[model samples]
Target: MHQRNISTRLKRRRAGDPMREFDALPPELRRWLAEASLPWSPRSARRIWRQGLKTGGVDEALRRLESAEVATLKRDRLAQL
Candidate 1:
């Protein structure tokens, strides 16, 4: 519950500003966000920034992290099979 409140406050405070959100997150999450964004070209990254204006950028980043984790798990499982 306490952690949830902290996350909520962080989201409310940062809103659409992904850089601020990146700064506020713990090191691991910040690293993940950076890695996920790294594949895009500058123009594509700018488009992401504009899109994030409507959807909370941090939320999108977290989703990206989740996606990467799921993909890794799937790959590992397939290798075992």
Candidate 2:
């Protein structure tokens, strides 16, 4: 239930050069990108990200988002039923 200063983490990430140009992103965009990189079941990933927001880091949050996006894409593909 603790909130980490994501800005600080981002600054560190930028300094480390693990990611280039993330500095220009808004927090929401950054979070979304992080989510897009996770490997999990779509629904489960969304749930995990929601939970992670309560106590997890940005990386964890991103993984969940990624899963959720995948799930959504799959669902959409199936919707032409």
Candidate 3:
């Protein structure tokens, strides 16, 4: 369901082009994507890092990355259920 939500949101963005679509999302959602391990490429992580740098500078980007780790834990818990 979480995966589906991400996909659906992405589909509505930037002519179905994922990179542009991803770039279009807000920081919170981008952080969520960075943390979620659903068949993503290393480039996606790089993109999130770049987005972080662009919007809020290095510190904010790092903070977002840190928050992303928390999502991993949540995703794992959800998977277990």
Candidate 4:
């Protein structure tokens, strides 16, 4: 497979059906994704979404996603150092 970027450590083979996973996302999350910096895989997003839902609720899940993005950015930044 083609490499997107070399420095970042986060990468995974996308599992399951992407279209169905994306379509199942709440509209708010889809909109949030529109503004996201990371190209979040559908499976990852859904996993986090469901995890957040289980732990708290939609708002909590959104917060978790934002946190995940920030953490990824930090990791990429460190990789560049």
Give me the candidate number with maximum lDDT.
Answer: 4
Please write out the lDDT profile of model 1 over residues 1-81, one tens digit for every residue. Answer: 111111111112223656554565556454544555223223333444445435766667456545554564455557667
Candidate 2 or 3, higher TM-score?
A: 3
Residue-pair clashes per candidate, as listed? 0, 4, 0, 0
Better of 1 and 4 by TM-score: 4
Backbone clash total, candidate 3:
0
Query: What TM-score, over all chains together, does every model reach?
Result: 0.35, 0.40, 0.44, 0.75
In candidate 4, what are the lDDT values of residues 1-81, reduced to their tens digit? 433323456665777887887888888788767677777877787788788889999899999988998898888888768
lDDT of 4 at 40: 81
Ranking by lDDT: 4, 3, 2, 1
Please give, for residues 1-81, the per-residue lDDT of candidate 3 as tens digits.
Answer: 344223211212123467776687667556655656353433555566677889897677666655664575466567667
- Indicate the TM-score of model 3: 0.44
Scored by lDDT, model 1 comes in at 0.45
Give candidate 4 regions above 4 Å deviation: 1-9, 15-17
lDDT of each: 0.45, 0.48, 0.56, 0.77
| Model 2 clashing-pair count | 4
lDDT string for model 2 (1-81, tens) is 422322211111112332444544447645565545222233343455556676777666765565655675566556645
Candidate 4 TM-score versus the reference: 0.75
Candidate 2 residue-wise lDDT at 76? 50
